[model samples]
Target: MRNFALLAAGALSLAAVATVAQGVEDPYIWLEEIEGTRALDQVKAWNKSTEELLAQDPKLASYQSRARAILDDEQQIATPDRIMGDLVANLWRDAKNPRGIWRVSPLAAYRAGKPAWRTIIDVDALGKSEKQSWVWHGADCLAPAYTRCLVSLSPGGTDADVVREFDLSSGKFVDGGFVVPESKNTAAWVDADTLLLVGDFGPDSLTASGYGRIAKLWKRGTPLSAATTVLEGTKTDVSVSPFARQDGDRRWTFLTRGKTFWTSDVSLLTKDGKVVKTPLPEDASFEDIIDGRLIAKLQSPLTVGGTTLPEGAIVAYGLADIEAGRSVAPELVMAPTKTQAIEEVAASENILWVKALDDVSGKLFALRRSDDGRWTQAATALPDNSTVRLLETAGKSDTAFAIVEGMLTPPTLYAVTASGTPAKVQSLPAKFDAATMTVEQKFATSKDGTRIPYFLVRKKGVSGAVPSLIHAYGGFRAAQTPGYLTGQPYRAGPLGMFWVEEGNAYVLANIRGGGEYGPEWHKSVLRENRQKSFDDLHAVAEDLIRTGVSAKGKIGISGRSNGGVLVGAALTQRPDLYSAVISGSPLHDMKRYSKLLAGASWVGEYGDPDVAGDWAFMSKYSPYQQLKPGVKYPAVFFYSSTKDDRVHPGHARKMAARLNEYGNRFYFHEYLEGGHSVGADHAEDAHRAALLMAYLKRELGGKK
Candidate 1:
């Protein structure tokens, strides 16, 4: 927005959601009309005005050029996406291919840096041929042979995408193959002829959150209507998605319904032609099945067969035991510590890979199960301050690819196997010179005396306070860690490259509501406690000021989506601390947030505003509702994409309009397309980045 992996009432129509004000007098409600002519006209005007302000800077073109070059650098590694034996596939995007291309290359040739890549699908070429702006969502293929594949393409980058069957070997879409029309859906291949699907079947098919609640088994050569319902969930549920796990010749299919954002109901379609539900806690997450054992992560303390596993513990259960209707007895795999939390867990046929955050630094380890079924871990020698993650696992193979990189280091792809140490396969070329830059881990005490960690990146040999920018996401249990700012136009890392290169400091805060420390770190900031996340951001800014790292009024905050709320709250609550705010695809107008696109699904995180109790706490800090007259707020820039079906652009639009009504000054911009990322192509991204650079420079007094 995989932040594509990234969600109102009962499937509310756009028109109905836009019109319902929930008893609040919203004069700017007209902006909620997503595609309404008047609303779009106003958006155009605001975009123009923001452009005019940023264009006043003489170096706007230069800034944009630098940003575009870094984003489109051809020297960047063609990261392996799906690995199948000797053949590897990836989505490649560069100057020539803006939309990207799904291509395959031989493993040996690829490792040698000269691979014969077969273009399975040239997205830019296909878009030109079809006269449509098709953004490549992804491609899922059958394992082993990997000839047949399902390709998803989004129109203008919406969450809803068209799924079509393609021939991976032939590099062509099958003429009489399967196709699902544009809708938010989940699909998995049970076999070549059978697919388990959860998508918009029709009017009553989708849940209240606009995701499919009904799961069906679709057979080849039959109408989608002919598919039989395999499972179903309530409309109030977040959604039901299909997941398939394969080991050797055995494959198990399951449907997981999100009872809430934090809970799930896992139903397995057994080989005996029976559907069985696994009795797991509402706060537990099923990681995957490995070697006939069920792997799960606990978010809270759970008593399983008289053994209570602490929160953030990784445990295993016998698949046969779970399916046999026996009391769920499990084996403890990994326990939690105050400073350690399991960030990722994935398994190949033979080895289990786990990536954990120890004091905000990434550590990788491999696990092996003994004959007695007890698992032991072997810690890897990967350096600290880096984000290590598994990229892809080959079918029935003991090998997988892992990416390792940090704030100042370029991302390198490594091939990990059960036998030996990880070997580097490819490394991304350095985008910016880091000789002058330095990275440091720092702590800030929040309002409740809770210790918060953040990464501070800046030029070395600095004596006095400097202008600083802080980027953070304090929601959704998504752990924010150190990584290079080198993907999408907004490869937002805890630390930024261009800003640090300019001698201005960059801060990446690991505030509450993130999975940095564990489930409790995120759970501590949910619903009524949401304001604490905002307070954590303020604490970081104050800490910087107190430490003489950044002076008062020399600080700035930037966040997109959930991060948007953080900066927005800071503007209204602690405006005097920061000098500028950039809120992108943010959530404001807390009262109407539930009715907006995909807003209802997030009620578990933000709480239901329609409820009087929820609104009591929300209204106190809702930036839009808290906007007052004659308050000296800092320089603010709000951006959102009209085509972003996930987070409604109205959040940014209505907030800016309210500020304008109060005669408060702010910068607002809206892109007609570009989906959740805000811009589609390099030009659009460069333009936006240029504006951001100019705005930050002017407002923060950075000599750029």
Candidate 2:
């Protein structure tokens, strides 16, 4: 959704495709043609200019090396994507194998630091043989045996992917097996010869959000069109996808209809292939089947058979009772407090893993339910003040993997079970120089007096106002955590290694519209209130200046996708606040957001531009419409991928066109591939990040 995630994820103002009905004519509308000759020509022209300005720098190679060292570091843990009974599966990518390979290793040996490897699919080889630029999306394997799988592969890194059934044991794609043509598709294994699928059946089969609207159950030896329709949500629905979960002897199949970005409707798909509405509330998210019960996270307060679960509470309902249509009360598993937010929920055979953030710091807990239907939790002994994410979870056993890292700590992998015993599996070999850097948590008072939190990292003992960069994504319930600026390539993009090393203090703004404190924190700045997120960002920048960290025009702001909105707003709404901006795959043309692919899905977050009231507030901050002539703006470096099917590259193209028309100077680049992310591979990611870094350094003055 780069609304590129982590999509609190994921967009800018009401996302949509556009006809440019905003009274004013859009001269750059032709750029929305995506791959049109004229559009690509303009893109090439801008890309040429960009290379001269950024890539031509003598230090460009160094910037790229720093990025590759983090992205393609061979020493990086081979964190398993799934832990099979005695095997661990992962996708490995590097300088040589940029397209990556899906391979597996024995679990016992992997835990002990020795992995006897087995290759499943060599994506680089497959792509070469098939004459395609293949990118690994993921693989959904059948349960228990784990020998059969529906492997998804994307061409040119687009959201749409071609899914095929492969025999894991045979190390080959099954002859005449299930194959879904290139489309944003979903295929879940229901049984050995059956599947619950959502795909591009034909015209009008997809929703306005550019996702499948029909869910069907397809059996072996049947034409895909003959598959029985399981559920049909409206074309206006955000999306509709099939769901299947296997837990020991039980199987839970359901249909999930995403009504909006935040709320959805779930219905059970029974063994007899009948679709029945589940008793669970529509807004409640069915996370996974934990133990013998179906676990759900309540977005709003839900009343279940006499008891009401508070918003942001996790509860469990027995699968049998749910399937039998019996009146069943839910048991609360994890209830979030004001300062606590549930980050992720995963499960093993007996253990339910709940990764929560307590005051913006990572906290992992292993919650196990007793036979009496009571739940008890044990907090894992992972280092506090870091970001702890569950790297892999399995329904087969209690063995789960977690990764822990912080502003100064490199990511360390761990193996944990229901007993809350976490064994250090592998620790990141390299560490950022913490001795020279100082990390601190600071709060900026927003317009409404809310204390917005942010993390600042810089060289130790450096006094006075210095050049700096502020990065934030203040939309979607995505939380901004304390990330290693100088170590992790993800947190600060490529700037993590170079920018901080050059003495620029990097700031991460934990503004509203993020899950820092929970859903309420995000709800505070939605739609009409979205400007609060902008106000909150400006507040942080103002706080940095007022706190003697930097002066106006000395600081640079950057964000992508939804963060794209953040930087776009910062540029258009508060031009005097910063000197430079880096916005990638952004949502600038808010007026036409929904008309674009996936824009309709984000209406709940940004509001619908088609609706008058929604657009009334949306148009006010819609960056595209806010551009004015003669107003000095920080030179913005806008980068987007032409293959991006999520947030259209047109948003960036149009914004740049408008800026140029308004006599403002900006740098722009659009990759022929790379989808909505940095790029299709690390090389591309490094180059994209390098360009942004070069722009930031030049704008803010490279050295102290």
Candidate 3:
């Protein structure tokens, strides 16, 4: 097998400099120029060629059979939305009570632990709302008591003024409401009574440049007169910490911002009205802040340690001078030297907990302050090799919870003791028993000899080929690993279907583009090595078919965001390998993606299309650019939101139009308000999951 590195080099060399010089053309232009008839013909030709290749490759045939077996097993239960919902419910249950759900926005809370203190709020009598959809954002909680909690409600999803607060104690809503008349408000809690809201001020308030000033802080009850300005407008970048903390006698807020392309700022806002901002070291961008003082800053041109980081070394940071209030220059700590990534960080006054990624597996570490005030580290926990997402923690308890799952293992919640022992706290409803389910790991050699890892989950008694769904995301150094299973209601129920109950789904951890194997793995397929990513996905598909998990005609693929881009590239490059594809809020037109908001910042990962060398590497797999003249792709579903300022919704809109014009069967659903996520409320999420699963069932052929 050729090494992935060698193959990436070879692929990069194949594209010509002249062709790469075209730069990023407006995707709208491509949509307008490419005649539907001509595009359809090109898609057909590509699909036919790929089918012929698979037919000739016996290995590919066998892998497809294995994939089918996994998908076809009849004994497994079906429940799509059940997974996510149950997972959330279980986490709430383990928190003991009064827990709230937090998400990515207001980066401060996300880092500080958006959900914040576990027992600080109320959690009883919680139920999903009917009118609102995509409830992930636009919600806040007030800690009325340990058993009494009040949750802010947004019925018009995340973008409208719709505001109502719920009393978890009595499972009813309180009457006082605040609705912004001219703009939409997304709420965040600064304290029980204070809200930090982000929203457009109104058309009249917008600048001449078509940009509007979105306020970052607003007091709920106190008059604006008493409030302080945290962030003034859109021009000044701001992000909140995931969690908040008190240092010495002051309450501190940590955030990162960029005033220009070359310089980024990380600052600490003290409660006493003083802002301490530090410029990132020249040529470096701050990724995240782990502990309050330990910062994860990436230098221009990101590089994983030449080797993968040792197990438990995923989170890297530069120590700052505690007393001096500044980062120590030229110092790197917890740097991984191999295929690993620091995923999460949790700390107390005396110790810090860090989670590291090794391929698709996870490891945890405990670092403590020494007598001399230095840090000492040691591996404290090693759960069964699987995918893990940290759930919650009790302050200074040294105890934490996580959701763990594997290909065959349904996701389940587990509590980790201070001693690091994992105790199963709750098991998702088992429509199928683990004893009857078979889960295994298999590797496929990439075009270059790099082994790509994948997992197969199926029923034990099932025989022969079955329809299968293969999920993958081979970009942005993200990894897909095993974890606890979400119930069928969350996974398939809302969709009027169920999991194995519906059929089988496979997860592929493709190589060269994820943190699974470390920085080296990601580098092998980044930018110029982009083709390697598509090939890695292709290799996994072939391996599944060869193993008899599924037949060529029974397979489907799904991904979101960058993962969505992976699906786009694969569909364009190897449509024969899948019967359907789901690309959600995907960054498909890579050549021009960076031009979007903050897109320029990611050049470190995706490469600059304007540069000759990089463009040569990107053009080969740039999904939109690679669409052929005569090919028929499997039915594809493209979903995005109009308010998604992060990755422009234009990507999906253009791709959908292009595919439709080409006479291909595809579905396009754009939400008008939910921001980046198409769903805004619980009901919205349930509906979206249903739609996605329904589409998969229709294309993949589920429980008849």
Candidate 2 vs candidate 3: which has greater TM-score? Answer: 2
lDDT order, best first, reads 2, 1, 3
Ordered from best to worst TM-score, the candidate numbers read: 2, 1, 3
Those runs of model 1 whose alpha carbons end farther than 4 Å from true positions after fitting are: 1-24, 111-114, 324-327, 395-397, 485-495, 702-704
lDDT of 2 by residue, 457-539 (tens): 88888898888888889878888787656433342355765677777788878899888888788898989999999999999
Candidate 1: C-alpha RMSD to true structure equals 5.3
| lDDT (10s digit) by residue, model 3, range 345-445 | 65533456667776567777666554454556676454567777765543334555566666445555555655667666554454345675667778888
Global lDDT scores for all candidate models: 0.81, 0.82, 0.52
For every candidate in turn, the CA RMSD to the true structure comes to 5.3, 5.1, 11.3
Worst 10 residues of 1 by lDDT: 1-10
Rate residue 589 of model 2 by lDDT. Answer: 88
* Model 1, position 203: C-alpha lDDT score: 80
**Which stretches of candidate 3 lie above 4 Å from their native place?**
1-244, 247-250, 258-263, 270-274, 279-292, 295-339, 378-382, 422-424, 461-466, 484-505, 523-526, 546-551, 589-619, 639-650, 667-676, 679-704
Say which candidate scores most in TM-score: 2
